[model samples]
Target chain A: MSLQIPDDRTPDGKPESEQPQWRRDFPIDWPEDNYISRRDFTRFLVLTSFAFAVGQTWILAMGSMGRGEDRQGRELVASVDDIPEGGAKTFTIKGTKEPFLLVRMSENTFVAYGQKCTHLSCPLIPQPEMGRLYCPCHEGAFDLQTGHPMMGPPRRPLPRVRLEISGNKVYATGVEDHRL
Target chain B: MPVPEHLEFFIDPNRCIGCQACVQACAECDTHRGYSMIQLDYIARSESPQTVPIVCMHCESPTCAEVCPADAVKRTEDGVVQSARKPRCIACNNCVLACPFGVPKMETPMELMMKCDMCYDRTSVGKKPMCASVCPSQALFYGARDQIERQRPRSRPIHRFLFGRQIIVTKVHLMVPFESPVAPMDVIAAFRETVIGHVFGPNFSAETMVGGGK
Candidate 1:
């Protein structure tokens, strides 16, 4: 017996010419395929958000892991008697390898600064003529008394440091990190 | 070209003290809403008079407006040049160098073009410019361009005479010096113009003060 070709096609079969126009716009050789279906785009956006969230979370985790309370790395800096009243000395404290300023304001009182001008991070030198801390780089001057901008180009104050003196010795405890 | 009221800022060299109080005051009052009035340096040589602070006088024909590739610098109806948005300025320094008054400054962190805006906000509120307000010596003033004209006769006669003479002679001097290359154009022009105008004229004896005769 001869089997004749079926007049009706299989189920869900449609002719190529009768196919919907949805896929026609997405042709090959297009420069950038920016167009995407709503479902596909939503999924992609969700994935991008997840990636950003992961990156932010990783940064936060690294930051939290780096800083710890109760720092115990204390060291002897200099002799307290070596620093005269209204005089300053240089020392490093707390994670920074750069030197900082330690000024003995009075006989028993002491103050310290990072010795860097905030405008250009230039080394601040003491100007006895003007009675201010001067930056030779941009002529930025900060008040010796208050660490505020007295003249020149500095926009922020020098970062202050914390110090402790016991008997005839000096110790650099930590930094105040005063930002302006 | 016909100028709109011939806008120009007349600076008196003898009066200015170069305190830079204008710079600080401008920073305080005009520096808000993401804008800052321009600040300038005070560079005075030994013989020169003290340097004075400057702002945009809103020229009748702004060189900045002509050279802007993006058309970002715009002049308001009241004749003030302002930057509409953060320009993708090529850092060409064309406007900076083209300006005769040297008002345009290159801002950092972006290296975009910057200049004065004439304190439009403060002026609108019936207050003087921040620079004028902060001037301790009362050296600065702002008003209609015509107001300065009326005040010039009484306040600044020598300046007006020199400025007018310079305006007239500069054009004539530009023509005489073609390709000699003996000296610079400015010096030769100034010397020739001064000597020729005053030295050999009718009633030249009456002008004894021209050559220290008086």
Candidate 2:
């Protein structure tokens, strides 16, 4: 595969190659970064579609009823190698509105929670370099370990999403009604 | 031998937020004569709002210059590929079709060919080009090699691109992941993968489509 690309641009100064098109929409690391095989790509698509289908059905079911409905089931969020320890990746569940962020704390422990600030439901940016998730909207911040509100206008702790790891794939099992 | 030093124009397509500040700023440059030389391209507009800015790659052997029948386009000593000059350009549109990077544009109203000149007026005076100057996300950053490397640690800047077998080297660089191949990236192959291979599993005989394995 490397044979296609040669480094012979030593004299004329070559311009940059365009980024992959999917990168613009997905905004995730390359398949190489995730160490994804062809099988994994298929799983990603199927699981994503399945999650979306289930979410749609849930919405239609709840629209006719008075009580709330629980968004149940597992969705593949990422592979284990997608992010290094202490780093985080944000993803959206099918049939849900809020985004969720997953943090890899150590070798075996990965924690996920809603990315929204409790104060205004603004998406919080994970700044692992600063050891806390920060919301630029109101200077709201949450601790990496506990998802507890550390400072600013947020009064409630960020909701946690239950996670299960199988093989090298990571799955988001269930989300709380609002936060997760 | 060392090439020209107008190496400051760097693009990180991933970092581009499609603000078009660069587009607005480029048209504002005094040298461009109120016409923006930069173009913003959307990958899949209906499906995605991602965009990347296009500027002259300033190829070492510029196809735009080679194919110009009137011989109007010129490459500066410092590696800037200037737009077709007024006296020589016939507005034939040959350069428009020949450029692999699709940087050149025909100004229909002016009856002339024009493209990014890296804002020679500002750069010659030791300043950044208009696009690089106003890019809000630093998608079009202008700096020395060391400066860019310091800013993007996880990514590597690449200047060589393989449009089929023709290796087109340019004055500017695109930042890609560090593990990317040293060989000029195969632009066409990547395009094919994005369009076809992703939609239909090419090797469907033995591979599992979902979960880990069958």
Candidate 3:
């Protein structure tokens, strides 16, 4: 049987025989292959560098803008009579989706805090009898008066939502962002 | 030269109670956007309520990064595997399917690949990952190799894993019994057989187990 060689040509349509000896002999072009690989790698590195720079710039911009823009000031959450002493009510902040808990500690005293637990963002339930906010998932407890982590794995205090009493209305105004 | 501080995470499946504290804490990660990257899976519930917490193992040669057509997945200089770059991610799910540990998940709504970055925001500052912080049980432990080794002497930290013929070296360490080289496999087998006496300790009753039904 006669040996048949398949016809292959360069991108320019030049026949194998018509090309330079180096090009014909070393069709794989190891040096060129290496160059292309290095080029791609360099390109990737440059792109990555650009991405990092952009990320840094974005972080800087966000930092400069400040987190205050998201804070809602003086939003009515509940009335004094809505919750009895030792009773708690959950309310969502106005103009935001954040949930806050309002607890009436005594006849005249009321406290409010961001509903999420400091340790894991678990919705905290107020244990009126224990005088604490408890995370059922891990039994993490926070002092009802201060929102300070009392027991369990939580190390940080719950974010205290500032409350204002006007006549009989309890308004959630500002928040103490102290994270324990 | 002094050994580099390669802080690896050690997960003890036997200690995981599946309370989902880690999952909740992971979502609270500053950069996670309230999305949890950690997963708690029940190894066996019928016989025993044993669970395993799965996070990004952060392999030395991460297959997720290698398979990403968009080059979105990245590994930090410290070897922690990061989530896909939101802008560059094409939501192809290549990394999701390529990950050996099944860590990466496609956030369909955002069309981005999300996975555990080992709470890099906190870890970079020398703080433990969120999952490790609120684990309650010492299932997820993150710290310097020497410190962790001292705390739990019986279980050795292992970074090498064998998948068929391929040997994968992970940046995150897995705690396995000191006597076994194939720790993960052995642990799984032990769990399947419900050999709590061997895995845990002598007091291996249901009442003794965390969150176990008596």
Best by TM-score: 2
Clash pairs detected, candidate 2: A5-B183, A5-B184, A6-B183, A6-B184, A13-B170, A14-B159, A14-B169, A14-B170, A15-B170, A16-B174
Any runs in candidate 1 off by more than 4 Å, and if so which? A1-180, B1-10, B31-44, B87-90, B144-153, B156-214
lDDT of each residue in A1-180, candidate 1, tens digit only:
000111111112244345355322321111222345457789999999999999999988885764423334446777877877677788876565766887776788766676888787888887544567889998788887777888888877776555677778877676555552
The number of the candidate with the highest lDDT is 2
lDDT of 3 by residue, A1-180 (tens): 000112211323356577677544333321222223345789999999999999999988875664444366688888899899899999987665768889998999999888888787899998978889999989899998888889999998877887889998998778777742
lDDT of 2 by residue, A15-126 (tens): 2234444322321111222334457789999999999999999987775563234567989999999989888898888887768999888888898888878898788888
Computed on C-alphas against the true complex, the DockQ of each candidate is 0.00, 0.01, 0.01
- For candidate 2, the per-residue lDDT at B106 reads 98
- RMSD each, Å: 34.3, 33.2, 33.8
Summed backbone clashes in each candidate are: 0, 10, 2
Give per-residue CA lDDT, model 2, range B1-214, as digits (tens): 2233634678898899999999999998887899998889887676787898998877766778767776577766566678887766799999998888889999999899989888888888788889998888898988787888888898888877888667777767888888877668775564555442223323343444564333
The fraction of reference interface contacts (C-alpha pairs within 8 A across chains A and B) present in each candidate is 0.00, 0.00, 0.00
lDDT of each residue in B69-178, candidate 1, tens digit only = 54445555444565433634566667776554557765655656767765667655556667777777645655444665465444531110122122111100111122
| lDDT, candidates in the order shown | 0.55, 0.76, 0.75
